[model samples]
Target: MTEPVRLTDIAELAKVSEATVSRVVNGKAGVAAATRQAVLAAMDQLGYDRPARSRQRNAGLIGLIIPELNNPIFPAFAQVIDRTLTLRGFTSVLCTQSPGAATEDELIEALTERGVDGIVFVSGLHADQTASRDRYTRLITRGLPVVFVNGYAPDVKAPFFSDDDAAAVQLAIAHLRELGHERIGLAVGPSRFVPSRRKAEEFRRLMAPVAGEAEVERLLVNSLYSVEGGHSAASFLLDEGCTAMVCGSDLMALGAIRGARKRGLSVPRDFSVIGYDDSPLIAFTDPPLTTIQQQVSSIAAAAVRALLDEIAGLPVPSTEYLFQPELIVRGSTAACPSS
Candidate 1:
């Protein structure tokens, strides 16, 4: 049996009056949609069953495919997307990829078999330069609505949303340069990924004026997007006499800090480091990380809107949408020790 609804508890939780709660509970017509949702959410939270008439009917199922949650940024994206879908009356099916797990193709097949209305891809195979575009083409040809985040495949006819990788690299380089660092190293992920390629290209272009083309190439280190990868890259860059470093992710930045410490060096005192993706709780690290922040909420909302438009048979431009990233300064970076 369901518990009795408590008007005071629900109203307080939803931040509305008892009358509003009563109206929502009774399925009254005057309450705004947002207000109704708030009331319903509050009721759900308080362990009260919503009146059958007030229950929401799901609009459709949206397939959300992303990388493993070990990376904090991926979860942040997933959470925003999931909440937005729920608010829009859509059910979201989250699919994650990892080693020994289902591949992207397999996940798509499963979601399609289950009759999802559309799909959202976050840093999936669409982002890999080496991956075939045929998979995406086939989906579009079948009249299925799809949207991509953080990756672009021009051959694939769909809306793409991403953070400006080149701009992020430029901002980090400029900040480090202002701190009087002459020899700065870049630690990024594999070149096959679109983001990594963009950052590397920009790093080479910007550093060319300072280090020259050939020497700038040596300053760029390709590694995994993990702490261990950052550590290994840091060791090599340190050997190259780099006084400051720009990392591809917060995880890598942490690894670089660890690497510096292992060599008996203090962060920002001996070496300055900048990271990408100002992910949650990063500001609370040993020496807070200075990073480029991706606009996750804006990107997620835009991608969801584009997918819904495509589902509604509305025209959406088949081009990439780039969102600007902000540079967040913290304790991880400082003036060059030698300067």
Candidate 2:
């Protein structure tokens, strides 16, 4: 048998009075939804079982489809989105795609069959220039409420939330330039994805004035958004005599560091590196990374809000919303060695 829940213990943990805890525990209607959630959370944290009547009935199910969880950035986004949905009384059904796992279409089909109230896509095929947008069109045609994150399709009628990829690249380049590094390179993902394309284009436009068109082309390297990809791209850039590089993701940055070390070079002493998506635990890496921080919390909250509005039959403009990213300077960068 489960131990009884002590009212005083819950009140103190939840920062509410005994009466409030009692009301929440007994399933009274007076407590605010957020407060009730808080009480329930406190009970869970304290290892106390909730009263059967106090359990909340989920308002509806929301499908969240993301590329993969291997990348820390995706998990970070998932946590925020899931928490926000829970607070709003909705249960989030997360569908993740991997090399041999179910495809996006398969996941969407399963979600639709389950009668989800809405859906959110993160870095999905909508971001791939080569992928067809007809799948999204069919969903919209069926009156399904959907939202896209980190991708934009001009013809797709949905609200999109994305980081300012162009701005991110510009910021990284400007910072390296200010450090007197003229031989800067860009290591990004495949050009087919929207974010990679934006970053690469901005890199070319900004570096053209400094490195000329021909040299700028040599400075840009397209690879996978993985550590191995970063390592390969960095090897090529290092051979091109690039003293600094701006990577598409923090994982790539870590790989670049490994590659530079393999070439008998010291980071920030012989070469400098900057990364994007300042993912969790990146700051704890040896010589904590200097990276661009995507506004994950803000972006996730905005995406959830827009999705809820659509589900509520509110008029939501089908336009892309770009959130600004911040540059987090750390130990991974310094004045160009020759400077």
Candidate 3:
């Protein structure tokens, strides 16, 4: 080998001191496990091929494909999945899609080509009812370990992990109803997505009595799962005298807030809004959003574990695993204007 490497170099990469690297190098064994891992990771990151005799193989890699990162919820899920995978000794490679760049199909091909031991698709095309199911069937036929999240397609042989969208809507409606809001509207993404579809269907059923013909018609607004969409949808509902709104995503809720403000009204004071996903940064919002909180930690863990189970040839339940969402009460909701 070349002249003995300096301990200081490893310390810098590890963000520790030369003494810490020395301790790890000498195998004295008093280093905190995290610190030891840092030093070891630093070595790997530096491209210093460890002496063959001292090298250790990694557990394996998993490919995690997400739709986009603009929405905070996507990154929140990414963080949880990444940490959970790393802790379980699996390295997760996150591939996020850009507007016009590589699509999910391309990402799937790329990951499998690189030999990822398994893959977890979060809010991917698998969740799109219109997308061809053959793509997933092909992967299944090839025996690639895969898990689906936030959507269910029975034709594909993979475990589906999703939050209870219907239950989420039910909770939002009950919260508003209890607060004395009679004319409540559901602002959601297109009806194509599974979650949106589930919410819309449930909302109509739950509001049928309190929300009559003309009231319900003007109340249901189909908007994109975005802020602008929320703004636009809320504008229409506001004209119909809707005093409460349930949005599909936190971003849309932010948009709805903007919508309410445009009409010279304040949130929870002029109108009550509820959002889904409880995406990161929402808690810090101006009024803080009252939202249906997805049990992200549990959902992420279940997805990872299910993928691993599939990889080992162990059979996992094929049914959709539904986790109930809890409603987080924050400043965004309150007694209806009249109540």
- Which stretches in model 3 have alpha-carbon errors above 4 Å? 1-56, 213-215
Identify the superior model by TM-score, candidate 1 or candidate 2. 2
Per-residue alpha-carbon lDDT of candidate 2 for residues 1-339, written as tens digits (9 for 90 to 100): 967768898999999999999898888888887788789889998888787888677899999999889999999999999989988889999999888999999999999999999999999999999999999999999999999999899899899999999999988998999999999999999999999999999999999999999999999999999999889999999999999999999999999999999999999899899999999999999779999999999999999999999999999999999999999999889899998
Candidate 1 local Cα displacement, residue 233, angstroms: 1.0
| Highest TM-score model number | 2
Alpha carbon deviation, residue 146, candidate 1 (Å): 0.1
* Predicted structure 1: lDDT: 0.94
Q: What does candidate 3's lDDT look like per residue over 1-339, in tens digits?
A: 766557778889789988887776766656775676678778777765555433224689999999789998889899989877765667899999868989888998999989999999998887778989887888888999899889899888889999999999999999998999988999988877888888888988888877765567668988998899999998988888889999999999999999999889999899999989998789999899999999998999899989998888899987899999999999888788876
Question: Candidate 1, residues 1-339: lDDT per residue as tens digits?
Answer: 866768999999999999999998887778876788889889989888777877667899999999999999999999999888887889999999998999999999999999999999999999999999998999999999999999888889899999999999999999999999989999999999999999999999999999998999889999999999999999999999999999999999999999999999999899999999989999999899999999999999999999999999999999999999999999999999988
> Which ten contiguous residues of candidate 2 have the minimum total lDDT?
48-57
Q: Judged by TM-score relative to the true structure, which candidate is superior, 1 or 3?
A: 1
**Best model number under lDDT:** 1
What ranges in model 1 sit over 4 Å off? 1-5, 27-30, 44-52
What's the CA error at residue 176 for candidate 1, in Å?
Answer: 0.8
**Count of clashes, each model:** 0, 0, 0
